[model samples]
Target: MTNSFINQWKFFYPNKLPISHCFRQYFSQFWFRIHSLPESKRYADTPAEYELLLNRHNQIIDDCFDSNASIFIVTGHYFSQSDNNKIYDPTLRLKYEFHPEKEINLTQANPENYDDDEEDHFYRPYSINEIWKKNEHNDLLKKIADDEVRAFMISFEQNIIIAPYDGGIDFIIFNDAKRNELINKYKDWLSPRADGL
Candidate 1:
C-alpha cells in the first residue's frame, strides 16, 4: 500500500527537499505503533499475508494503548550489508520515553556481543525531541542526499524487510543466500508498479 504520509510529503516538498530528508521528516512526525510481542514473527509468504500480520500487530498495540498501559515505544531500523560474501544484519534501536531524562540504554537493555575495539559502534537511543531536532539539520540533509546519489550511481538494489516483533527473530535475515532465495520466491510480489495505479 502507498504511504499517505509520504505521498502528502512529496506533494508539499516536491523539489525543495531530498527524498531521505522527506523520509526522516515523515518518520519523526509519525512512528510505527507496534505491539511489544513476546517473540518475533517472520513471514516470507505472500504480500497479503504480510499485511495481515502487520495489521494484527498494530491492533495489539492499539488495544494496549486503549487500555491505558504505560507503553515504552521504540523504533528499530534494520540494516543489512553484504561484504566478502558475508551478510551482516544490524538493528539500531531508537528508544523514546515519556521522560527524556529516563531514557534507557538500549545497549544494556538488549545486550549483544561486540568487539572491544569497536568503541565507536553502538546503538544510541534518541529521545523524541532529538529525532525532530535532527530532522531540521542541513548537514543531515546533505549527507542523505549524497548517500542516495551514491547508491543510485552504484545501482544498489533496495528491498523492504519486515520482521514482526513476535516473529521469534531478533533481526531480519538478508544474507546473500537468503536474499536471493527470497527475491526469486517473491519476484512477482516484489515487482514495482506505476504510482497511483
Candidate 2:
C-alpha cells in the first residue's frame, strides 16, 4: 500500500530545536511509534515561509515569532507551488486580546526583558505568560491523544494549533515504557510562543 499520509511538521514540537530539544527528543520517540514512513516527510516545509531562528534561548524565541509578527488583525492565505500559503500552519496568526481599560499586569515583572533576537518556530498566544496557561488546552490535548487533526483544538482568537508527534514509530513504539519516558522528558519544553496578527 502507499504510505499513509502524516504531517511532517508533527514529528517534533512545532517550535524549533535547542530549548525545545526535550520535546524534539520526546517526539522522536513518539514518531517512532506511529510513523512507518520514510524521510520524505517534511512536506510542510515546501510552503512554510518562516525565517529560521539562529538561537534557542526561551527569551530569544518569545521575541522572534510574535513580537516580529503583525498583530491586531490576521488572515488565512492559500499558496501555490511557487508561493507560500499562510494556511500551511494554522497557528501562524495570533494577537493578544486584552481589555484596554484595566490595570494591565504584564506577565512578568519586565515584559520587555524578553530577548528580542530570535523567533518562535511554532505558535503561541501572545498573552501566554510563563505562569499563564490556556483555559481550553485540555480538550485540545485530548484530541492529540486520540490522533485526530480535526480534533486539534485551536483558539480562533489565539490561532494556535497543537501538532501531532512526528518521526513516527521509528522514533518510539506506542504505549511502551520508552513512550512514557519520552512524554515525561518533553512534558515542559514543547510549548511555542509567537505573537503576530
Candidate 3:
C-alpha cells in the first residue's frame, strides 16, 4: 500500500521529491483508520463514491497543469478551540492551492530585497475564510459542481472533493458550522478579490 501510494505521488509530481517515507507511513496509518470508519459515517458514502470524488479532484489538478497554473502544496498550523477557556496549540493541517497563482514564497529573501515577481512559486499560508472566498469564483470548483458532472457542490476548505448529488437543494459545500467560525473570524479582514485568469 505504501509503495502504491508513493508510485501515485511520483506519477503526479514527477518534477518534485517524492513524499518522505515518514509521511507515507503516517498517511498509510491514517488511511487505514479512515477506511475503517462505517460507510455512513465516513466522508464518502461508498468506495465507488470515494473513487469518483478522487477522479474529479484529479481532473481539476490536470486542468491546472495544462493551464500552467503554479501549484503549491501548503502545510501549516490551524487554531481550533478546545473545551477549556484557554486556546489550544495550533494543529498541523495540509491544504493545497487555495489560490495557486498567489502563493508567493518570500521566506528565502531578505525583506529589504523582496520582489513579488521573482518569488512566485513559494507556498504561503491563507486563512480558511480566504480560501472559501477564493473558491467562490474558482472555475475548477464550478466545473466540478456542474450539472453534467452531477456534483452538487465542491469545496476547498480542508480537502478538495466534490459532493455527490443527494437529491436536495444545491448549496455551497463550505457552509458547514466549523467553517462558519473561521469565516466569521476573518470577515473583517478584507473582502474577497477576484483572481485574474
Candidate 4:
C-alpha cells in the first residue's frame, strides 16, 4: 500500500488498530452487526444454511459497493515472539489463498501477561485490491463462515468496511444516516440485545 492510502486510513481512524474486530468498538456510531443465519444461529448446519450465510454476506457487500468496485481485501497473520523478525513468508499466502502483496505490521501496544506461558505475538496484515462482483467471492466468504479465515473488505470510494467472522458480518459505515439505512434494511438479521453486539 502507498503511504498516502495508509495515511488516509489513519486520518479516518486515528489511534485505532487496523484489525476488523476492533473497529466496532472504536467506531461504534458508524458500526452495525448482522447475523449470517436466521434466529441468531452462529454457524450453518447444512449446505442450504451455508447458502444462506453466503447470500447474506454478498447482499450487504453489494449494498456497500458498486458493480466492479475496487476494494481492498485485508487479512492478518500473527507471529509469536520467536518469529517477530520475519516480514513475509511464502507459506503465509498458502493459508490465506488471497496472495496479498502489501503488508503492514500492527504490534500489540501492551502485551498481556499470560500465566499459561503463552508468548506475546504481533499481527501483520496483508492487503490486496480486488473488483467486487456479485457471488464472485463466495469461496472466500464460505471460508469465513466456517471460521477458516478472518478477513475484511474495504471500499475506499464508499468509505465503508465489511468484516466477516464465523457467525456474522460487522459493518463500519460512512455515517449515521447510511448506518441507519442498513439497520432498517436488515433489521431482521440484527441482534436482540440492547448493546447491538
Output the number of the lDDT-best candidate.
Answer: 4
lDDT of 3: 0.28
The lDDT for every candidate, in the order shown, is: 0.26, 0.26, 0.28, 0.76
TM-score of 4: 0.82
- Pairs in steric clash, model 1: 39-166, 40-166, 40-167, 40-168, 41-166, 41-167, 41-168
- Please give, for residues 1-197, the per-residue lDDT of candidate 2 as tens digits: 12111112223224322112133354443332221122323122321211111111112212222333321211122222344444553233233232122111222322363346232222221122222133223332222223332212112222222222322212223345644564355333332323100
Error of 4 at 173 (Å): 0.6
Q: Write candidate 3's Cα lDDT for 133-153 as tens digits.
A: 222323333232232222112
| lDDT tens readout by residue for model 1, 92-112 | 211123221222233343346
Off by over 4 Å in 2: 1-81, 92-127, 130-136, 146-197
My TM-score estimates for the predictions, one after another, are: 0.27, 0.21, 0.23, 0.82
lDDT of 3 at 120: 28
Give the clashing residue pairs of candidate 3, or none.
none
After superposing candidate 4 on the true structure, give the runs of residues whose Cα lies further than 4 Å from its correct spot.
Answer: 1-7, 83-108, 111-120
Comparing 2 and 4 by lDDT, which wins?
4
Candidate 2 worst ten-residue window by lDDT = 49-58
